[model samples]
Target: MQTQVRVRGARRWIMFGAIGFGALFLVVGLILAGVSVSFLANAERARGTVVALEWRNDHNGVSRKNRENDEPVAYPVVEFTSADGTQRSFRSSTGSNPPSYEEGERVEVLYRADSPEDARIKGFASLWLLPLIFGGIGLGIAGVGTVVALATRGRS
Candidate 1:
């Protein structure tokens, strides 16, 4: 009888914790989605060329543990001609170990007329990936909590 009571208590705590964390993640995802939408709303599109690849090393604690396994990430430097006939160059915020683009590759860029320096690469991964990931995780976790609560309700 006592063990059953303890199990019920543990399940209750687990359910509440999952629900709480899930809600937090959901809110963060919503906020990120909102920011992305706002950025796209004021952005103008232009064609850009990859001028260079900036290689950077991940010198964090985890990477330090495995020196042989560590590889430098390549961030592309893109140059574009703005609407006002001014040439601007900016480095992409996204990077990959294998280098996603060649030096001469042409890609789309999204920027505001007021501040072309703050432009970003116009792609689904650059803009929407984070929100989708967070929202998906949040929903999954919340669903787990709901399932647990429902399955154990009758036992208690």
Candidate 2:
């Protein structure tokens, strides 16, 4: 005799959750891919002067050698005013290879005037890299989840 498995409403919900996570991962992955491509495609256009720079480390992005004694590092926020007279702020993560400009400096920034809030500093490739990395992971997971769901469908 073979072992039997049944999927009730709750189990179905569990499956739904797994699939939902995969779907969400894919969606987010796509969005990140777009952003990454845009950034790469229009790197020159993303250039902007450094208007305001602030530190934001609510998530503690920095640390010392041990990563234990280091305090919560904040980010460097640079606000820029596009040619259209609109101002936007871009955050520089502590771990990023690029360094943020000092206050009232003319620094190059890569960003979409439409959503300047999501941008990276001129020297920072982290912004562009992150999306690709995240998208790859997301898409890969989504693919695996899809395959699993299909394989275990009615039998679930």
**Which candidate number has the best lDDT?**
1
Residue range 1-156, candidate 2, lDDT tens digits: 122334355555665676677677667767876866777676534345655445433434543453653343334566666656676676675332133355566666766655656667766345555665666766676676677667767565
List the candidate 2 regions with Cα displacement exceeding 4 Å: 1-13, 45-56, 60-70, 74-119, 122-125, 153-156
- lDDT (10s digit) by residue, model 1, range 1-156: 999889778879989999888888888889989999999999999999999999998666665766876789999999999999999999988888899888999999999889889888887777998999998888889888988888878766
Candidate 1: which stretches are off by over 4 Å? 1-3, 60-63, 66-69
Stretch of 10 with least lDDT, candidate 2: 1-10
Question: Candidate 1: lDDT over CA atoms?
Answer: 0.89
Each model's lDDT comes to 0.89, 0.59
Best by TM-score: 1
**Could you tell me how far off, in angstroms, the CA of residue 11 lies in candidate 1 after the best superposition?**
1.8
Give candidate 2's whole-model lDDT: 0.59
